[model samples]
Target: GLSLEPILLALCEWGQHHADELNEMDRLADCIIRPRQARQPAIA
Candidate 1:
């Protein structure tokens, strides 16, 4: 498997340099993981 420590470290550095972009990326990831309709109960 590939080592992620270096990649994560780089991401942290980048995030520090570009906080706003990182925040936007986090928001986009949240949207992707939890769409609006996901909050509703499924109708069986």
Candidate 2:
């Protein structure tokens, strides 16, 4: 209950602190994935 609140809050704060880095990672992942997705032909 209350015990987990502090840990969750801390985790949220940590995530916020690394938001930029996380966003960059997300962008890089998308960049890598998109080309691979595009290269694959869709089945009819």
Candidate 3:
């Protein structure tokens, strides 16, 4: 699972320097974390 704390902190820092680009990067990060699926193995 992705940790939102560090991401949010980094985004805040980036936003201070590059607000527009940070917005786009935030969108991309959202997409990247959405489709992850966990796997389980069957026992015989």
Best by TM-score: 2
Candidate 3 lDDT over residue span 1-44, tens digit each:
54575686677666555746555655443312243466778789
What lDDT tens digits, residue by residue, belong to model 2 across residues 1-44?
55566676676666655766667535332211111223568799
TM-score of every model versus the real structure: 0.38, 0.43, 0.34
What pairs collide in candidate 2? none
Tens digit of per-residue lDDT, candidate 1, span 1-44: 13555676677666655756556655332211222333668799
TM-score of 2: 0.43
Tell me the alpha-carbon RMSD of every candidate: 10.5, 13.5, 6.2
Order of all candidates by lDDT, from best down to worst?
Answer: 3, 2, 1
Output the worst ten-in-a-row residue range by lDDT, candidate 1. Answer: 28-37
Worst 10 residues of 3 by lDDT: 27-36
Compared with the true structure, all predictions reach lDDT values of 0.51, 0.51, 0.56
